[model samples]
Target: MPIRVKLDDMLHERRLTLSELSARVDITLANLSVLKTGKAKAIRFSTLEAICRELDCKPGDILDYSAED
Candidate 1:
């Protein structure tokens, strides 16, 4: 996928664990894990907003795009 989930990097930068973020965002650990691992197929806008709210970051901080060869 050209779009990459940079959730792990954002968590690291914020000194937060997946479990911590899950609790703060009121999301299941499994779902957050999927996103963190870049295995998720899609994300709800509400979910994105929750993550951004807890992480104090913009959407671009968690997602990136790159051209695939």
Candidate 2:
């Protein structure tokens, strides 16, 4: 996957638990966990907005693009 998920890092930096983030973002823990673990195939912009707002971060903070070798 060229796109990497940085959710765990941001969460750790903010000292936030997955459950806390889920509640804050109004997303289910299971769904958020899938995203945090890089198992989610896609994310809606609305969901992204909620997450960014709650975490006070940009999409780049949670997602990154990398070239394949």
Candidate 3:
């Protein structure tokens, strides 16, 4: 996928575990893991907002787009 999720990098930079992020975002581990691994097909704005607010980051910090080769 050209669009990628940078959640792992953000979590690493913030020194946070997926469990911690899940708690803060009120999202389940399975779902968060899906997102973190870039396997999720879509993300709701409210969910993204909650994550960004807890992580103190913008949506760009977690999401990126690259042209497909």
Best by lDDT: 3
Task: Name the lDDT value of residue 15 in candidate 3.
Answer: 98
Poorest stretch of ten by lDDT in candidate 2: 46-55
Candidate 1 per-residue lDDT, tens place, 1-69, comes to 999999999988999999999999999999999998889999999999999999999999999999999
TM-score of each model, paired residue for residue: 0.97, 0.95, 0.97
lDDT of each: 0.95, 0.94, 0.96
RMSD of each: 0.5, 0.7, 0.5
TM-score of candidate 3 versus the correct structure, residues matched by position: 0.97
Evaluated against the true structure, the overall lDDT of model 2 is: 0.94
What's the best-to-worst order under lDDT?
Answer: 3, 1, 2
**lDDT value for candidate 1?**
0.95
What does candidate 3's lDDT look like per residue over 27-69, in tens digits?
9999999999999999999999999999999999999999999
User: In order, how many clashes per candidate?
Assistant: 0, 0, 0
The residue pairs that clash in candidate 1, if any, are none
